[model samples]
Target: MMEDTIAAYSGGTLPGAIGICRISGPQAFALADDLFFPTKGGKMSQGPFYTMRYGQVRAGDGRALDLCLACCYPGPSSYTGEDLLEIFCHGSQAVVACILERAMELGARPAQAGEFTKRAFLAGKLDLTGVEAVADLIESQSAAAAKNAASLLQGGISRPIRQMREKIFQQLTHFYAVCDYPDEDLDPFVNEEARKVLEECTAELDKLYQGFQRGRVLKEGLPVTILGRPNVGKSSLLNSLAGYERAIVTDEAGTTRDVVTESVRCGDTVLRLSDTAGLRETSSQAEKMGIDKARESARESRLVLCVFDGSSPLTEEDRQVMETAQGLERAAILNKWDKGALDFPEMEQAFPKVFRLSAKTGEGVSELCQWLAGMTQGEGETLVTSARQAALLGKAAESCRMAAQSAAMGFTADAFLADGEEAVRLLDEVLGDAVSEDIVHGIFSRFCVGK
Candidate 1:
């Protein structure tokens, strides 16, 4: 356990209904006794460790700060596995400042960023994956994001990693025993069984690594580019999807001279929509720069929405739009459907997934939204959202593949043993077992001070 006691304002913004001051360490209870006086006239350190008591919180000079409730939790049972105290008081900023000042005066230092959670980690209350999940849960913006983060916090990824590590360790143990003692009646190390185990672990790790991109889409939103010529209603489509007038719509062609971005939530999925300038030959330098950016956005995005005006006959510019979006994952959006549709044989061949929507009336937008939401469709499976976890998993999978190859080729035990051991070491780092202190500090540095 840490030697010095630490305290911080665990409650978020102050000046509201309630505020919480958290203290944890060896001197937590002693500091509580000095700062709070119970209404019924008994010390909290005496009995009823987990119960809260009505009290008056006082400053360093014995001046009453506020009337509130205080609770004490003894060591090995609290959140940090240390004696902890919590003071629930009014949310006034002045009151909280005085209480914190008094805490510092009484030998409790101010807590650092994520110190409380780091303490829990060091005390064995949480593993590395759980530590990361705590941060993920706090930063989750949607219900789908929160659900996945909650599953990670509940050991959805760590459990399988631990099981795979155990299985590899067992295989290593059997090989070592068979080589060390030739006279014993132990079961022989069969190459086929060992190869199967390694292959299974490799496949599982690959699956997890593959899901990282989808998890990123869930957490960071999918990138989408709107591509079309001037006067094609691309900006209108952007405004319709955003449910607001995000981009200015005008009857004049080439009104939008730059890319306008807005994050639109289509059901559970979030699309980072970019309404780029219309693609056309222009003399203006600014419009030319915008067209270049539009093409760049199409190259970088996962999906491109190629738009065309359905009320007018297809022009050469429309054919250029299709050619620009060639070899890309794209869909056709025929805008101004309320005005009436036109038949285009080439458009039908260019885009298999086509949607005819009237951006002015918001008709047929829901179908497009539903299609975008289903693009990232691994809902119930475990996903690795952190880049660190995904990189380690990929390396571990490669190591397991090498080990499986050695086993299948009937190589000597030591040949595959080196790769197997490296795989376990990488897996341990993923679990925060063999990680460096610098990495640990870097991971927790992203957390808020109160956490």
Candidate 2:
């Protein structure tokens, strides 16, 4: 059978000024020529590669379907390393459907989710890391996440892995050569040099592994749970941070009965803010369950925003909330500062980070947002955003450490050599040098159609 030509709508679905339908495969250009007739009266196949032509897409009966623009990208230079064509048409579902149907009739099949990117991977245009980065870039919600994904797509993580693999391979090659020569004037593999190289590689791998903690937060917002007694402006605070009324705020006590979550961008950081029911003892069964859930959320959160009603005198309930937040990574927010302050020396002593703010007036919230952003900021560090990459890096680091330990203990060359080889193998998997088909499919499966 002839190679299947794939087609899909690649642009946003909403009614916009324009929409894009992309086609790729060996027959992509031929299919475009069959459907798109240039207004200047020429076939699209005769158009220069990478050039867009004003055209009217037609049906099989030569009926004008839509006035559109068409662009062609020849094979080996296209995104999928195949002849690719893109039709820029009116952003209407009817127009998109008609174009897709015409392309199908001309021998184009619908592209599967991530099939375009998967083909790019198979064509040697992108590694597995790069392919994952493409997915991340599409799904990124914050500037930090997009920046990190773009860096990974540009080989920020793969370059270091490739370098480490090369170093291990060099050491292995020298060891093998020395063993084969016996006395043929090849310099012996120096145990000290091998140990140094392995130690360096192990340290680098450990750094990348450590980066996952911050990387995960950058990619998928930092989990922050708001804790405070009823009527202390917890919901108002959540709305203030989110810049919208995500939670209903009223003067009524215990108004929030469940955890309300919203993700908001603060500088480069994305905060997954959970506004839980005010922590308080209640006779109502539902309120009691919500209170229990509040505590559970606090425990699972990476950071806690402990809100205090600065207008009211410290109560036993306030003390209990503060006590619950003790020993966790927390910051105190003295809310309702507009109402006037009350002395709370205990809060000052318990929490190192405290912000006095009025959620109603939007006062002093910028400082808290800045602090949250600073928590995950780093300078030019390679982040391991994928769990698979983190696991492989952990294994590679362990193997390097074992190799270094073997060399330091004066074990035979074979002992350290085996560990070094294992390290190289793990690094290979990290860079898609040697990975299973299932893993590759799983990674690409997360992508959307037309990527």
Candidate 3:
């Protein structure tokens, strides 16, 4: 409940450089007074808020726990928009545990997972998108992901959505005013103006919705599959890209009997590489199953690297691999270039993006990595990182489109008013305006405790 004071350990793992114990709520300063004493001898709540003060944290029995730095943030200006206290102490498991135990013993409850951010949301400090952005920023794996999350947190996605909502609200307001006050001399609603506004909002929402796939790839690495006949250096190429011996390599055929996956950093982008079993006929049941999995992996992959042995001429197995790669976003890898250069005119003709790389020597690997990274590059536009945001935006876009169609068809304002109102409501849900308590708790639950 909002009436209760909450405390949590907001630091990294034990034995870190420092540990942070955060206490927030109406009784936060009271708990601070009980647990922490300023070295200079004054109540922390008296004055000089937002400044860290050197202090000694004492346990319930009046024994010192640890000498530390403590800061007081008197709210409605703190992260939770409530009275908050943060104690910076040595990051010992025992010390953090003792301090937290003492705070709870003095009536401060343990903070639930993401309760702080949830409190911020309830206190009008953050919108739903911004709260989701907090989780995305914390879980981001790469620089691009982090940058996008930071933008979302800073209102990149929310700002445009809010503007769209405002325009729709204005249109709705005018329509309602004209209808409700037919006796008054008010400006009549223009069908053309309403259509134009709806069209613009619909287009913007569509564009944002379209970027969800790429944004998803930014968060969860692009799925890539390596396909080739046995011993064509498919595993070797995976190892080369992974910068380690991720796949076992042997001169014997049918070495890999399953899909070996690795999420490797290809330049700036992450590639979820699946090194599948060789795509060749086999008498072994397990190897055949593996080959089936290989084909399935290629089908599901965003990019398929069809590898071929440059040393040997085209074989039936290699031709089969090429045939399977048809209609897929694919590239050709003329692997084992160090052995001998052979003119594979068919490979060049079938695949436009071809790379001659010796997986053994790691030659041409950097170029491939750079190219893979370039595939995920954006033009500095805001992206929809959360699936929930994208889904709602998509629905809102469809609603707007339907309403625009009604306006263009010369229908009365009442005909399109339902859809227009639905669009506004959906957008509100996206911004956490009318979302349910369950949804809010579910969103914040994704965060770790003390966030």
For 66-101, candidate 3 gives per-residue lDDT tens digits of 999999998889999999999999999999999999
- In order, candidate lDDTs are 0.90, 0.89, 0.92
Reference-based lDDT, residue 186, model 2: 32
Model 2, range 105-206, lDDT digits (tens) per residue?
999999999999988888889988898889889989887789889999999999888988999888777667656765643333477788889999999999
What order do candidates take by lDDT, descending? 3, 1, 2
Candidate 1 worst ten-residue window by lDDT = 181-190
lDDT of 1: 0.90
Query: Which segments of model 2 are wrong by more than 4 Å?
Result: 177-189
Judge candidate 3 against the unseen true structure and give its global Cα lDDT, from 0 to 1.
0.92
Better of 2 and 3 by lDDT: 3
Better of 1 and 3 by lDDT: 3
Superposed model 3: Cα runs more than 4 Å off? 178-189
Clashing residue pairs in candidate 1, if any?
Answer: 15-91
